[model samples]
Target: MGNQPSVPQPGTPLQVIGAGLSRTGTASFSEALRILLHGPVYHGGTQLTLAASSEIRPLMDIVSRFPPQNASEKKLIGNLLKQRLDGYAAVTDAPFNGLIEELVEAYPNAMVICTTRDAESWVKSMKSIQNAVTMGFLRFILFPIPGMRHFPDFVDLMRKQWWYLYEAGEPLVAETYYKHIDYLKRVVPEDRLAFVDVKGGWGPLCKALGKEVPRDVEFPRINDSQAIDRLAKRMVQEGLKRWSIGFATVGVVLMSYVFWK
Candidate 1:
C-alpha cells in the first residue's frame, strides 16, 4: 500500500456490495437495493459526484495510484473505503465493479450481488447509453469549461477504472464482463454471493438478501438511454446559460471601462 490512508474499524451498517458493471441494470438494482435494505444505496452518479468533491478528492487520487490487477491493491482500497464510506448501506456500478474484491474484504460478511446480462445485450445497452454523439459533445464542449470540467474528469477516471474508455471493440467489453463475473465467483464465498440477472426480477434478489418481496411495488428500471441523453442535453444547456451570463458580465465591464476612460 503506497501512502495508504489509515484504516477505520469495520462496521456492519453497510451490508450489501453490488459487483455489477454498468449497462447491466445497475441503476435498477441500486433502487431495488435501497428499497430492500431500507437505506441509501450508492450508484455511479453518486460515486462520480463524491470523487469530484474537494473533501473526497483523495478517493480518485488513491484510485490512480493502484494498478487494478494487483491483488494487494484490494486490501489497500478496502482500508480507504473504511474511512470514505462509513454510512452507506450498499454500493453499485463503476467503481465498485472495479474494486469488488477489495470491498468484499472490507465488508467480509456483506452480501455480494453480481448482476449480469447476455453479452450481446450488455454490449447493445452500453452502446446505447454511451453514444458517440452525446459523449463527444460533453467531452469536447462542456468538459473544457472551468466549472464543468471536474465532473467529466471524474467520469473519465471511472471509465478507465472499469476498462470502458479505450477497448478495441464490443467483444472486449463482453470479455471484461464475463471476466468480472468469474472473478466474483472465485473471490466471494457461495453463501455470501448472489449471481443474478435483472430480467429474473425480485425473486433471486429478494431470496439472496433474505428480504420480503414487496407485492405492491414493481421493480425499478431506470437510466435508460433516452433518459441519459435528455440529462446530457439539459446539462449542456445549463452550462451554456452560465457561460452566456459570464460573457455578458465581462462585456458590460469592458464597455463601462472604455466609456469612463
Candidate 2:
C-alpha cells in the first residue's frame, strides 16, 4: 500500500477521528460517537469552555502549528497532539476539522467520520456562532473579565481555522464550505472515510464502522448556534466569581482594621 496510515497499537484509547468543520452537525456527531463508542468524546467547543489557563497555553501552541510544514514537522505535530489527546475516544469540532489529514495518520486505526450538511446552511450557522462570541458587546463584556485573557489566542486560532479552508481574498462562505468538504474527501481514504449527514441518522455511519445501529436511541440533534454564548457566559461567570472572592477577602480585612481603630 502507498503510505497507508500506521496501525494503531492494540487497545488504543482513541478510535474515532472526526474530519468535519463545526456547525456541520459536529455536536450531534460527537454525542452519537460518545454513545456508539461508549467513551468520552473530546469536543472542541465544550472543551474550550472548560479549559483553564494551563490547558489553553499549551493547546494554543499545538493548534497554531497545523497543516505542518514537512514530513518531519508533521510527525512532530502528530506526537505533540497524541500526547495530549490520546486518552479520548473521539475528537471533533472546530480545530480537529482543520487538522484532519494529520490526525488520520496520527491515530491510524481510528475510523474517520466526515460530517456533512447543506453548504449555505453551514455558512450561515458558522457566521451566527462567530458573531455571537466575537461581535457586539460580548467582546467588550468578555475582555474585561480575567478568565478571558487568552481571548486573543482564541482569535488567532479562529483566523488560522478560517484560512485552513478559506482565504481573505476569496472570502466566499458557501464556496469555503464546499472546499472544506472536498478537502476531507480527498485527504482521507475511501475505505476509512464515512460521510455522515446527521439527518441520515445512524445507518450509514454504523455500517462504516461495522457498528450495530443503536436500538431505541435516536441519533442526536444539537443546535449549536448558541454554543458560543454558553461558552462565553461560563468564562465570564467564572472570572467574576474568582474576582468576588478576592474582593470579599479585601473587604473583610479592611473592616477588621476599621473595628480596631
Candidate 3:
C-alpha cells in the first residue's frame, strides 16, 4: 500500500453532525441516536484554544473575519475536532460545514447528519441568543466592565459592531444557513443526510436513520413563542414605568434651575 487511506469496515456506526440553531434539539437527537446505534457520542465539545483561558474566563468573542468555508481555516478546525472525537462512535452539534468540513472530510465513511428547523424559528432563537449576549455585556459593563474595560476604545468599537451585527446579521446568517444545508444535502446523498425537524416525532426519525426507536426516548420541547410573548409584554410595561420616572426627574431638574436663575 502506497500511503493509501483506510476505509471503514462494514457495520461501523455512522457519524452524526447536528447543524443549526442553539436550541434546535441537537442534544436530544444525539442522545437518542447514540442509544439506538449503541455508539459513543460526543456533543458540542470544543478544544481549548490559547485565546480561551482555562480559568474562569468569559466566552471568546470571535470576530469571524471570513466566511466559514475558507478551506484552510476549515481544515484546521476540522483537524481539531477530528482529534477530539478520535475514538468516539459519533459526533453532533459541531458547528456548520464552513467551520467543520475538515472533520467531515476526514471521516468520509461516516454518515453526515445535518438537522434544520423552520427559518423563522431559527431566527428567533438566534435573536434570543444575541439578546442574552447583549444583556451579559451590559451587566459586565455595570460591574465596571470585564474584558472591555482593559481597552475602552476596543469596547466602544465592539459595542458598535455588535449593534450593527445584531440588527443586520440575522438575514445574512439565515442565507448562509440555507446555502450550507443545500450544499450538505447535495453532497452527502440521501442515505447519509439525516434531514430532520427537531419538532418532528422520534419514531419516524429513528426509522429513517436505520435505528430502532428507544423505549424511553424523551424529546424535550423548548422555545415556545407564546411564553416569550408574555415575557416581552412584562418587560415593556416595566420599561415604560422606568421611562416615566426619568422624564419626571428631568423635568423637575430643569424647572428648578430656571426658577433659581
lDDT of 1 by residue, 1-261 (tens): 001111213452888888877777777788787778777666754444322334335566656644545667666777787666676678777666777767888888799998888987787777755563336556545653453456566555665665532332433466766767777887788889888887888888999888888889898877546555665676677667767888899999999999999
Model 2, 1-261: lDDT tens digits are 001112223344998988877778888888888789887777776665555444555567777777677999898878887876756788887667777888889988888888888988877776666665554444544554543566666766767766765662223478887777778787788788888888888997798788999999998877676555566566667656766777899999999999998
lDDT per residue for candidate 3 within 89-165, as digits (tens), equals 66664233333344457677666666667765666665653453345334333233233233233333334433332
Q: Provide the TM-score for each candidate, comma-separated.
A: 0.80, 0.80, 0.54
Error of 1 at 22 (Å): 0.5
| Deviation (Å) of 230 in candidate 1 | 2.2
The list of candidate 1 runs beyond 4 A from truth reads: 1-12, 46-58, 68-74, 132-140, 143-148, 163-172
**How many residue pairs clash in each candidate at the backbone level?**
0, 0, 0
What is the Cα-based TM-score of model 2? 0.80
TM-score of 3: 0.54
When summed lDDT is taken over every stretch of 10 residues in candidate 3, the lowest stretch is: 47-56
Q: Judged by lDDT, which candidate is best?
A: 2
